[model samples]
Target: MTRRRHPSLWIAMALATSSLSGCRCSEPPAEKEEPAKASPTIQRGDAVLVEPNAGDFFEARVLGLEPAAGIQSLKLQRSDGEITTADAVDVYKLPDESAAAAASKQPGLAPGRLVICEVAHQRWVGCRIKTVSEDGYQIEDFGGEEHRISLKKLMLPSELTRMNLEQRFKIGDRRRAFEREAARAGQPAPPPGFSPGFKERVIAKRGDEWFSAHIVRFHDDGAFRVRWMADDRENDVAKVEVIPEPPYQQPPKRGGFVLLKPNVQSLPWARWRVVSVRPELVLQNAAGEQSQSSRREVVPLDPDVAASDEESP
Candidate 1:
């Protein structure tokens, strides 16, 4: 059965339907899904700076990654054979050698580049460029000491390592050459107070006294390469600082008197008769007790001095 509807009611229903459709058309479009955030990646064997502790980063190689509890830590090894662990947040990638080299080539742009500097003689240390000058680059060390370094003394870490290894090989070769020269008939001894040359066993002056030493080689700069018998340390001894080992003298007769100093540091040289001269110098005092001393410690008495002492007594 058809029921009759009022005209106002029909018009109101149509108007409500039209309004709902318009609202749907004006709705904002669904937002596009954002791409998942990317995580930064670091691989094994990469050179990196790691801070095992807060605020203390050092150069190291990434050994591996350790993941635990949804967090990652880095296994890093330092140049000195020390292995340490650091959080991923504290690990930083270093510029590759190529990049570092390229940056170093532009000295004008080297204000913050990492570098190796030979700050003192044979002392290589890590540093950073602070500024550039017409003469050379000004560098600041890890300890905060600023230095004006010559270009020749500054290098990238990789370059310094290679150069250092080569230098060591060269020094080793020179040392071998020195050994060969020493093995051959030793060089002729020079006169006292004269400079020493290669392969000469000498009494080199250290402080005011002369000590037994030998010149085994020559420095690149022509300085005498002296090896002191006292400490076995090598030095670039200068001319006029070295002389031949003093010639040994014939021992006096058993009853003959000679001056001797039992203590090289003590005063008052005492008279003693010779007992033996081989192996070591043996002397006897008035009590007939024997004491041993080096042949070099025995000295001939000065007649004038002895006479003056006698006259004073």
Candidate 2:
């Protein structure tokens, strides 16, 4: 929904008199100036979803326009024939078919005819039309609810469906672009399922600051085209660099031998045989010397190496 200023207010003015004897009367009595009136975002006959109550939205048609509490309000009728009012900011417009999409429809279907259209996969529903023209057609269902369906859907109902404006920009044609980004950002994809173009936190290489970003496009070589989630700057950033999180590789099992990294003595990384389990790792060298070290110092065990024959089973 588009947001703009509410409607202006009505101000009572003082009586005005023609300037007489070269003297301005009353210095144009002080009056409160009216605020600038915003143009209505939704039109009289637009297809929109209106939120009649908080968190509850309903599909409705704009029947009239009026001012409600110094704001632009719309009179709408729902599919179930309920008439209610809502502010312009609460109206969401459905997507219109692009020029390329309209040309692909089946050849000769006129308005005022009852037709069945595929609303979803393997689902067909009946629709009635108000008027049809080159620009667009107004339509309603049996329940009298209006919708902005693509004209192309009326033709090849099997292969086509109504494309929403929000879906086109956020969820269609660029789904993988978002996934590759979530991978790079070290953020998990939504557990339930994928949401295309959803934003997640990413550390920027520039300042090393964490910022919200998402993929807007994808390169052939598997790089992300990113967009900033920052409200001040919604610019698209190409090829956002992401640092991979360090893999959590566990050390060798306590009963097994392991190697430890060098200590402050500048000693080399050493191979040690695990002698016992404790808060600190107890290790023995091949020389029959035992050393105490932090469990974290042990490196991962080599997959190709077999257990040492020196084990005390």
Candidate 3:
């Protein structure tokens, strides 16, 4: 009879077969498992994976929902230690409901907290958040000048971001109006007899030639004056004088034009005469008697006139 086979061998054979069967059943499936459906979540000061491969992810804080864009833009801290922005479509909510609720109720930037001032003219400009009045915001510019801006002219930054050419023009017009008003308020008023619009004509004499200049002034007497710019400088610089016309020989009878004394210093060589005398030319003479001689002819006292008078003598 054959020797009885060892029990251990049979047991070993069964164990081997069982191990092979398990290996066949445990082989990995060919298809990949889809990532869990991402849920919107507020970011806590924690690092999380943002991408599918787990290779690229950013550390960010969940600021708020941007419903319009339909994307969550997180305030992120970059690897370089700088705060930047990152966005994701699928965001997940935190497991802690109370924490999320607290974040939602926290106060953030006020609706009208920030403003931008674009300078239309002049240097230095800034913006401020002021209480809204019926008129509009009371803003202080970079020059520390305070201005009341109309609501129509003021715009939110978000709104300004979308401004077109026409919108910018409107804003510019409003700024100009504010500047003009400020300038007017800060300037002193003109004196009773003085007018800001008064102008004067200057007559200068050189040899036999005459020249005229139109100067802008605050008074009819040419005080507080500015030099007139000549269109033709060479021709305008010739010698000239004021001369009185015929009607000025008689004293002025009623309220009418008066001749203003010309400044002799302005025209060294020119002799002044009251030219084109009006009804107001009547004035007391040196003898204390009213005389029409108040008006006289103004002429240049050139070398020729002096020589001729001497020769006549």
The lDDT leader among the candidates is: 1
Q: Model-by-model lDDT, in order?
A: 0.51, 0.42, 0.32
Quality of model 2 by C-alpha lDDT: 0.42
lDDT of 1 by residue, 1-313 (tens): 1221111211222122433453333444343211111113356787665434322336777787665453356678886788987665544455554544544445353587665565775455556778888777788665557888766555443333324433433444454543343234222233333445567665454553445567988766545777776677877766645544322334344544555543532233455667776777788764446898764554433221111111110
lDDT of 3: 0.32
Write model 2 residue lDDT over 176-214, tens digit each, in one string: 443343234332112222222334333222233334445
TM-score, prediction 3:
0.16
Write one digit per residue (lDDT tens) for candidate 3, span 1-313.
Answer: 1122111211222122433453332444343211111122233353322221111123234433232353334454544466655443322222234443443333332323433332232121234445556534676543335666543322223222213222333444455554443333221112223222323444333344233444443433444333432333322221113221111223322322223233343433222222233653443311223434343322222212211111110
Model 2 CA deviation exceeding 4 Å by range: 1-58, 62-70, 81-83, 88-175, 178-247, 250-313
Candidate 1: minimum summed lDDT over ten consecutive residues — where?
A: 304-313
| Candidate achieving the largest TM-score | 1
| TM-score, candidate number 1 | 0.28
TM-score of each: 0.28, 0.22, 0.16
TM-score of 2: 0.22
**In model 2, how large is the Cα lDDT of residue 167?**
26
